[model samples]
Target: MTQNIRVVVVGGGYAGVMAANRLTQRDDVAVTLINPRPDFVHRIRLHQLVGGTGDAVVGYRDILADRVALVVDTASRIDTTGRTVALANGAAVGYDYLIYAVGSGSADPSVPGAAEYAHTMASLEEAQRLRSVLDTTPTTAMVTVVGAGATGIEVAAELAAEGRAVTLVCGKVLHPYLHPRTRRRFAKRLAKLGVSIIDGPDARVTGVSRDAVRLADGRELPSTVTIWTAGFSVPDLAARSGLTTDAAGRLLTDETLTSIDDDRIVAAGDSAAPSNLPLRMSCQAANPLGAHAADTVLARITGGQPTTIAIGFFGQCVSLGHGAATVQLASKNDIAKAFAVGGFLGAKIKRDSFPGLIEHLAHEAHQPGSYTWKFRDDTRRQRLQTLAER
Candidate 1:
């Protein structure tokens, strides 16, 4: 009888869960997933949760494979030498191979008073807490949303559509990821919905207070509730455990997604910086990365050469209130193209994309190595060349 390979996947987010499900295809492998939450947090819809239009959660039973065991506990330290992972609850799990996919959260030590006074919708718990605060805040009170990214825009538009006073303060640029024409379209729609957009020098936030947000230009905006969606930072489990990592604490991996320090350890999602060329932090990329990471591990176990990453990206989709959205098209390499879709049709596309993501994960669970994506031929060749040089 062949000895079974034991694989322990950390973090239950999209990347971790997808890798676990994909690994279940091999009968000779035993898969275990460790996550702090019992239910999967639809992180992409977290803005909607804060906006009160979505629940932002789904039970793991809906997507996880039956063969994969789920453990509801936080990972504390990783002992690569011993091939063991210690949980926050004082439990240790051993693994022949490990997948590190702890996703990102609101960057810590954020602007002063931001953590103490401002609200964030990065995680399920944070969104729930912010929703509670929003329910109690007066409708006429000023709500300042700092950041002009998709998260901030969605939150401001949702609240403004509901007749709440909203102001979006863009630090320097607004919708840096979108083309100028698309940005203008979004600006017009937001303005029509009564969301005031503050950009340029006067828009830079210097500090956050209980009742207002101070600007770098000595201007202050009165705010009853402040929402911060500025940036994201990954957990430090890899760095704390003495694994090779980037400045942001994301694990460092080669082109095959295997850790530089140990071949038995692999990484995926926002927590992985492969070849120091990390993919954009989005669910669109996370799913593919997870699948690819699992393939690398399986290849190693079977004495086969691991495949290098050749991932491409689609555009960004942002929800602007209930019946409006913007789907910015992207080039094969993921540069925002000038063309975009907005209005009700765009909203429909956005809604369909959400359910499509979950279904894709389920399909992978049922048929491993079945979820495949496309990339331009030239882009694929270029990526392969880059990996060869590495």
Candidate 2:
């Protein structure tokens, strides 16, 4: 009789949960999922939570496969050579394969006083805290949002829709990823919603105080609440675990999603840096990468033919103030294209896509093997050639 394969997945986010669910479907494999929290945070809904538009949590029992064992402990250290994962509670678990899906965190604020005063919507707890603060605070309170990325825009718009005075501070113009036409549409919507877009001279946040945000050009914007959605940075666990990682602490993996230094270890989600194709830290890439990582592990274990994973982004969606949105279509390579939709239609598209993605993930978890697609060898070859030239 063949020995049962043991797969340990760290982190309960989208990638880890998906991987564990898929792995549990195989009777020959025993899967253990480790996470600090019992509930799975719908991280994508964090901005909505902060804006008091949605609940930012889902139970693990609702999504985790019945056959998979849920370990409620934080992964303190990974011993790849020993194939053991050390938990914070001093329990060590051994595994035949390990999946590291520990996602990234909100980037550290480099600006003086920003870290001390600014609240982030990176996690469920932080979002809830921000929401609580917003709910209890007076309606006339001034809120300042630092950054003009998708998260920043969404949060600012949501707050503005709630009749709060929101000032969006962007180092550059808002929605740089969007086409000029879309940007103008968003700007107009924000303006109509009474949200102030402070670009150029007032863009940079030099300091954050209890009552205001100091700009780089010596302008003090009165703000009772300062929210930071600037950027993200992966955890340092990858680098500390002796894994080959990029400067940002993302694990360096090959086309197969296996770490370049260790085939037994695989990485996905925000923490994976696959070859020259560094995917962004979003649900768009996380779900696909989770499936790819599971497939890679299954291929190696079952002695099946090896396959490379390729990712192709569909488009970008940014939600403006209530019932408004901007959808920027992109090529498979993620280049911005001419096709775009905005306003109510775009909002509908954004809202519809969430449930669709959830259903797709549920389907993939239930039937893992059926989702495999032929590897794009042409794209792989092109990526390799580009690397060589570099």
Candidate 3:
């Protein structure tokens, strides 16, 4: 009888859960998923949760494969040389293969007192906490959202629509990913919904206080609620494990999604920086990368060839205040085109995309032997060659 291959997946997010579900389908593999939380936090819905519009929690048992063992614990350390993972509870797990999907955290502003005074909408807990604060606050309470990225824009727009005094402070122009026309349309929509757009010369947030936010120009805006949605930084787990990482501490992986220094270790989601095609931290990359990582592992175990993970750029979607939105069509490089939609039509598309993504992930998880995509050594070699030439 063939020995059972032990595969351990850390983090129960989209990438980890999808990889665990895929790996468990193989009878020869025993999969163990480790996470600190029992339920998976749908991070994309965090903005909605903050706006008190939706529930951000989903039970993992409802989604994960029955064959996969769920271990509720934080992965404290990874001993790659010994093929063991130490948990926070003083238990160590041995694995023939390991998948690190430890995702990222909110990029806190470097400004003084912002860390203490500002609330971020990065996680479910933070969103819920922000909601609680909003519920008790007066309707005329001033709220300032720092950053104008997707998360910042969405939260600010949603809160503004609820009749709060909201101001969006963007270090740069709003909707930088959208075309100029689309950006102008969104700016008008936000203004119409009572959201003040502070950008360019008046954009930078210098400090946060209990009752106001200080700007770089020595101006202070009265704010009872302050939200920070600046950006994302990868978790320290990759660097802590002594794995090769990028400047931001994301694990550097080969084309096959395997760690460059250790073939037995693989990385996916926000924490992974692929050699040839590094992508931004989004569900678009995490879901596909998870599937690809599982396929790479199966190829190695099944004596099949590994396949190159392909990343294609999908268009951008942004929720305008209330029942309005903007969608921008983009090329493979994420360059925006003149094609754009706004108002109710764009909002429908934006709302529909969330469920559509979940359905696609569910469908991919149900496919049989989906883990065994052929690997291309030539692709890896060419990527290395390109890097050398650069």
**Backbone clash count for every predicted candidate, in the order shown:** 0, 0, 6
Quick one: ranking by TM-score, best first? 1, 2, 3
Which ten residues in a row are the worst by lDDT in model 3?
A: 371-380
Measured with C-alpha atoms, the lDDT of residue 357 in candidate 3 is 59
TM-scores for every candidate against the unseen true structure: 0.96, 0.94, 0.92
Q: lDDT tens digits, residues 1-390, model 3?
A: 343899999888888888888886578898999988888888877887888777778777666777788999989889998999999999999999999998877885689988999998787777888899999999799999998988988999889888889999988799677788878887888888899999987678889999899988888999999999998887788788898998888889887889999999988888888883567687766777788888888888888877767655556788876667788877654568878887678989888876765665555556634543232223445556787898
Q: List model 1 lDDT by residue over 158-182, tens digit each.
A: 9998899999999987878999999
Question: Comparing candidate 1 with candidate 2, which one achieves the higher lDDT?
Answer: 1
Q: Ten residues in a row with the worst lDDT in model 1?
A: 375-384
lDDT per residue, candidate 2, 88-192, as tens digits? 899999999999999977899998888889998898778888898888888799999999989998999999999999999987788677777777777898898
In order, what lDDT does every prediction score? 0.89, 0.82, 0.81
Error in Å for residue 176 of model 1: 0.7
- The better-scoring model by TM-score among 2 and 3 is 2
Candidate 1 segments whose C-alpha is farther than 4 A from its true place: 1-3, 376-390
Error of 1 at 287 (Å): 0.6
Candidate with the larger TM-score of 1 and 3: 1
- Candidate 3 has a TM-score of 0.92
Position 207, candidate 1: lDDT: 91
